[model samples]
Target: MDISLVAGLLALGAAVGFAAGMLGIGGGMLLVPFMTMLFTAKHFPQEHIVHMAIATSLATIMFTSISSVRAHHARRAVLWRVVKLLAPGILIGSWVGPWIGAQLNSSTLALAFAVFVAFSGTQMLLDKKPAAARELPPAPGMFAAGGVIGVLAGLVGAGGGFVSVPFMTWCNVKIHNAVATSAALGFPIALAGTLSNIYFGMKVPDLPASSLGFIYLPALLVISLASVSTAPLGARTAHSLPVKTLKKVFALLLYSLASYMLYKAFG
Candidate 1:
């Protein structure tokens, strides 16, 4: 691997890990589009670029989420009951989502990613509290909600925090608990999605060297190295900062990313 690529991956990992810790996001949303650009610059096959990006992003999440979640769990913020309720459906939905995504062309997938990210950014920026802060719904409703979060996470290479954290908070869970629980949820989402992408992309053409299915080993290695060390720092920072301010900044960043992805997709 080139030194430049190594540097890029390290930088990306540092940024993503910090975001994951601070925002309770799995960081795949940032990882995906950025990796797409890197892969494109490397002259990876256009058809497989986005798929590789998504797969690699998910793979990285598996590690980063663990680090972030451990830090959050140390703070006693994770809601174990909620994580248990979400796991089954998150796994199923994440597994299925990649199969569906693999059927679409890269440009279409990019467009879809842009749309969802833009929407998520808008939601975070608005930061509207629900009319009523109520308890979580019944088992079935919670499970179904997990399914939705998983599907979107798989499709967009997120950790499901963008959806799940907000959902839990709206259900009257404390924001810290919601963020911590979302970090816990990222494990299943990343695992299921990563495995699905590996299987789905096995027959894909022209994947770059050092690639296992869609996960690029060099990038994964460097990124994981940087991210794992930084994640706990971010989790520590999260507890110290005003999350409202963090969310606003993160929301603006997401909007910028969404716009750039759209430009890349159409330009």
Candidate 2:
């Protein structure tokens, strides 16, 4: 790998890790567009750029999530019982998402990602709190919600925090706890999605060197290492910072990246 590319990946990983920690996100929304840009610059196979970006992003979350969640757990913020209830369905949905993604062309996949990310960003910007009377549903409801979130996360290469945090908040979960729990949820989503991407991508031809199916191994290694180191810092900041303000800033970032991805898809 070029020294400059490694440096670029390192910078991206640091930004993503901090955002993931502070926002209770998997950082995929940030990772996918930038990774797409990098892969395009490298002149990777045009048909495979989005797919590879998604795969690599998911793989990095597997590391970042672990680091972020550990910090949240130390603060006693993670809702482990909730995680247990939702995980089974999340596993199933995440496993299926990559197979569905494999059927779409690169442009279509990029379009899908852009649309979903833009929606998520809008939701964050609005910051509407759920009604006070609402509460978390029964286990079955949680499982179904997890399924939907997992599938979407898998498709878009996100950590599912965009959807999960909102859903939990709507169910009256506190913002801090919701964020922490969402961080915890990233593990299962990333684990299942990454494996599935690899499986589905195995059939594609002409992947770049050092690729594992759809995953660009070099990006995965560098990003994961750098991200893990900073995730704890982000998690700490989340407890002290003005998170709502930070989220608004993040929302703008999301909108810009999503727009860039939309241009990539159609341009």
Q: Whole-model lDDT for model 1 versus the true structure?
A: 0.87
In the predicted model 1, the residue pairs found to clash are none
List model 1 lDDT by residue over 119-144, tens digit each: 87788788877667477888898889
**Where's the lowest-lDDT run of ten residues in candidate 2?**
241-250
Per-prediction TM-score to the true structure, in the order listed = 0.96, 0.97
- At residue 264, what lDDT does model 2 achieve? 85
| C-alpha lDDT of residue 207 in model 1 | 83
Model 2 lDDT, residue 135, Cα: 90
- Give the backbone clash total of model 2: 0
lDDT of 2 by residue, 145-212 (tens): 88998999999899998888878877888778888999999999999999999998888889999999
